[model samples]
Target chain A: MELPQKYSEQELVWLLKQRNEQAYSYLYDHYSGALFSIILSIVKEEELATDVLQEVFIKIWRQISLYDTTKGRLYTWMLNVARNTSIDAIRSKGVKNSRQNQELTENVYEQAGSAEMKTDAIGLRKLVHTLKDEWKILIELSYFEGYTQDEMAKMLNIPLGTVKTRLRSGLAALSKIIKP
Target chain B: MNTQEYIESGIIETYVLGMTDAIESAELEQYCREYPDIKLAVTAFEATLEQHALLNPINPPSTIKVQLFESLKDEFVHPVFMSAPTKQSAKVFDIKPFLKYIAAASIILLVISGAMNLYLYTKLSNSSAQYQAILVEKTSLQANNQLIQAKALDLFNSMQMMTDPNMLKVSMPGMPGKEKNYATIFWDTKSKDVYILPNKLPQPTLGKQYQLWAMVDGKAVDAGMIGDCAGLCKMKNIPSATMFAVTLEKKGGSSIPTITEMYLAGKVS
Candidate 1:
């Protein structure tokens, strides 16, 4: 669906605060695709990703007043919400058990590769493939997986400083690919 | 710590990725405000990351949006459903006769007020529509008044110029073929300004206009085109002129007057 040109980002936010349904619909139509992909990346299950997406949007609507423009762009704040909510869904007991059972039957890397393939043949997949495994893993963990530096350090059996450096190098490589 | 080194430390990247803890993120935010370069770096990093994230879009099922909006509609209509109330035993209290009378009276009052509200609302809407119509009429009248005021100001200025002692009024009687056509030139000799009050010139045919000329030293210099011949039109000024004339010319006035088309001519004394 074509996004409405009726309201700008600030105006849309103001309308959303006033609980305007059309503004909410516009926000959903414009941002839901990327937000859904982010959620799917972390949860790794379509059903759970859908549930988490619904919850994320509800949270966005409910807590919209808390969003401050000085902090960042609205999309960036929504991205954070999606990432955190997806992480929370994965960490929940029911989802954790299901994810662990699935992990036992399939190789994690293979699953990730398949999920990457499931995405449309956009340039992002090609760009992601160009990164070395270490950089890709760091990006996936911090960006898609919503892992903190300390958690990533423990998860990867690396030091906290190493985790930060790897994340920096990963983003630098990604940035170069994005622009160049 | 060197700010450049601090930037190169990957803290901004981590911040963009949302990997930094609360305290570390706060410190980075402070540093970004303190250093312009750091802030720029952070903004660039955030933009790059945001673009990268957006590029991998996967559209959600279309039905989800409909279902979501439907749920939202329910919440809007019955907000009490949002928070589930715990079940408790119902308490029973007997109604007193005086309280019953108060309730009955309040219901009757509510009906009366509701009727009054409906009546007032209809009256208000009717009055507001009439007010809007009046406002539109007022605007139209104001526009017409401005046009009349402008014309009056022009006429007043022309009268003042006509009565000036330094002004010389020359009457150009019609030439032989056009005996009924006449035009008047009000020349301010001191200021070297010329104006024409076209009294009897017929409307020019399509693709034609009346051009006024100042005849100086036997040469007819192009004065100006009288676009609409009915008004007091200001024509071109010449330092000194022996005669003034009017001739029919093409849509745009020519450099030299068409002498054969001359309708009126008068010599200056």
Candidate 2:
């Protein structure tokens, strides 16, 4: 039976390790929206994004034991997985041809709320909007596109040091607003 | 850079965002473990990223969740990779041949188990029968022992009676035709009790019994009948009897002595 109540992160992790079906349902119910948003931001299309999301969940199930609680929160680790899997899907040969015409930078600054998704992150959206386009693009490229510092530096025709600085300042500004 | 400068350098941010390469991520993790402030900053950025991700919610189509869960159900029985339907076709092999072998092995095991059960049941019944026979034999032996014990006690009492000074043993000789048959009478003078031992009496014909008679005063008094007695038979009490005799009569004794039928005669001293 699906639990009606919320589980603490530790409780959820314990249930997940035991491979509890209810925990899997709870996990899907609780985090799929956020994860789907991240996946869609990368893959851009709902059908391909849906496939990427499913692959992300299967990876999470198979690699749940590898989750190191000492490093980060469950959502943070899952965000990483979702971003990586979506990037892999688009990078694969099948997606590259169909998606060649669309520029990656176009969707980099695209607001999730502007799409069909509900605007629950209006507060965070305003805070992100206040950030300079240069700083915002760096965070989006690395966070959503799963680009490394070197890759972002080369793509933007900038030094690797500038890419690292912008990403740091962008996260610092967002962290202040979100936590404040 | 030092740990504080390192914390401020945005490396932890890249690490939390999954943008760091393997070398950069591993080095940052080592620093995070070594320094609590670096660790705290890492956790804070990770939390910030989580909150940001949660804020940007886009629900996937409802069908994917159902399909994902349905695919996961197969994982419990055998490990299944993601989207295996396409990959599995190349690896499909037939298992129909092994089914008959499995069925045959199962049937053989069933037969062996049934036969063992029947054999054990027969052995148990045989043991039970043997146990019952031993019990019956024990009871019969116990009954025979009790009978022998009673006989020994009787013989011991008879010995005591013969040795008693107040007892007078009277010898009875068989009549003219039955000269070989003889008997004895043990008469206790003090108790006035009469007992007879038909020591060598022949088995009488059907419907006839050998009986004892005591002559008291001038009249013959009827003692008691002796019927197939192997030991001392207590006859009727006689007071000052001068003679004792036995004769074959009917199954029960006759009221008067049949002189022609007399088999033994004795004079008491």
| Per-candidate DockQ vs. reference | 0.22, 0.26
Write one digit per residue (lDDT tens) for candidate 1, span B1-269.
59888776667766765677899889988987888898888777667666766665788898899878877885443221223333345355554446878989877877897798789879977987787788677777877875775576467457667877788999999999899999899888888888899999898999999999888888989888896632578888778899999999999988888889999999898
Off by over 4 Å in 2: A1-4, A93-95, A98-130, B1-4, B76-269
Report the C-alpha lDDT of model 2 over A102-127, residue by residue, as the tens digit.
Answer: 66436532432233233233323445
User: What RMSD does each model have against the real structure?
Assistant: 18.9, 38.0
Interface RMSD of each: 8.3, 14.8
- In model 2, the clashing pairs are none
- Candidate 1 lDDT at B146 equals 58
Q: lDDT of all the models against the reference?
A: 0.76, 0.76
Share of reference contacts kept by candidate 1 = 0.45
